[model samples]
Target: MASTRIGRHVKAPRATVYRLLLDADAVARWQVPTGMTSQVHEFDPREGGAFRISLTYDEPTDTGKTTAQTDTFHGRFVRLVPDAQVVEVVEFETDDPAVTGEMTITIDLADADGGTRISAVHDGLPDGVSLEDNELGWRISLGKLAALAETGELP
Candidate 1:
């Protein structure tokens, strides 16, 4: 299986970063792109806990009808270490032909000079997937997380 890893250093405490990662409400606030909204169908934030995120991408329609494309993500938490690490297995459920895979994502945080060094590793990608695109997406998402933790604002 293919694996992609990305890391970012955030100017926030490890505890704060961990909380932001596990907080379902806070996750919906910062995990998605600007203008896109996410709803948590279920979130437990503990080992063996179930989690799901339904994201709706809204686009303006020229025909005056609001259009939205909805995608649902189902996953379970494999491990949870408060203020240190979280590991989850995520599956993408979509009819799109281009995307199909189960991803195991691990987020690690370490205390570094009054800040937190966050590392995200995504594994179990299917063949034919572009690592660059996956890495870029993770980078952007993590950057958004950092911004949220630092500024107390969602991205």
Candidate 2:
């Protein structure tokens, strides 16, 4: 298993960022990487709540974990602290053994100079997932999140 940590500073208040983190609609808008669209099949904003989402590539040439052009994932909220932190246990919806595993994602928010500082930790990456690709995807997604948070508009 592998792990990664990513950090970013958003020019928005922690409360605003936190709200976006828990909002299913907002997630669909900002949680996706560039060239991909996200669909939230289910979401429940509370500890122990379960959620399912899918990300589809705009270009069919891209490979997918769940299908030819999409990657689906389902998870449960392990912990939730209003405006502070969120932890989730996620698993890819796939039959490929190399990608089968439970991953833990933790997001921590803190007040920063005139904004919020976001710390994201992703652990338990399966062997099939490339670290560089995962980091790039997260950087893209977090950039979208920052844009949305700073402008209050979908990116």
Candidate 3:
């Protein structure tokens, strides 16, 4: 029942920021937490779309619930409003008792002075995932998002 929200301002237009957020390759590039690499097996960003992603910790010992060194998850895109917001209903591919249940995540964008203000809200965090870790993880992910958006790179 716990939730967390994080926000940042990116030096890019809302459309640019939104596009990067939904692109499969871009997600793989910027959504991973620091020290991890991510791969998007499947992704569809529109409403009712489905996506699957895997995150691997560089260090073997830092394994995750789905498999050694990896954390895999899948979700459905609950809502998508162009240049405005995206919502997803996600769940981890894990058997860990503490990390049960689905999480609702919403990412929103609004006009800033000269760019876009991005805000992400993550709801229903599993007990196994610590709050501090989630906070730091989001910060790192959003930082990458900002950099990628500013560069306007297609990956």
Candidate 4:
């Protein structure tokens, strides 16, 4: 029932930003938070397509929702609008009831003065996830996105 929204400006064209949003490799690079690595198990860049991804903590001591060090999730692309928006519904693979739920992530892109403006909304966060942590993760991920879009590199 909880949600978080973030807005960012990237010095890249909307089309470029949108392309990265749907690209598996790009997602693996930019969608992960700091101190984590991402692996794309399966990905289909179309509406109703399914994708599976895992985020693993670099530190061995860190716990994850699904396993000892990894958080795995599977989801479907709910909607896709070229150069505009993308919507996905995802559920974490976990035994813990507190972190079990389907979450919706919507990302919108628009033209900006020098580049593109991105608005991301994440809804239906499970109780196990804290708002501050979620927001911080998003901020880091978005910063990576911007860096990738602008310089073709993750920063």
Q: Backbone collision count in every prediction?
A: 0, 0, 0, 0
| Winner of 2 and 3 under TM-score | 2
Q: Measured by TM-score, how close is model 2 to the native structure?
A: 0.98
Worst 10 residues of 3 by lDDT: 146-155
Pairs that clash in candidate 4: none
Model 1 per-residue lDDT tens digits across residues 19-46: 9999998888777754457889899988
Highest-TM-score candidate: 4
lDDT per residue for candidate 3 within 80-135, as digits (tens), equals 99999999999999999788789999999999989999999999999998888888
Ranking the candidates on lDDT from highest down gives: 4, 2, 3, 1
Tell me the whole-model lDDT of each prediction, alpha carbons only: 0.79, 0.95, 0.91, 0.97
What is the overall TM-score of model 3 with all chains considered together?
0.96
- The lDDT of model 4 is 0.97
- The worst-scoring run of ten residues by lDDT in candidate 2 lies at 146-155
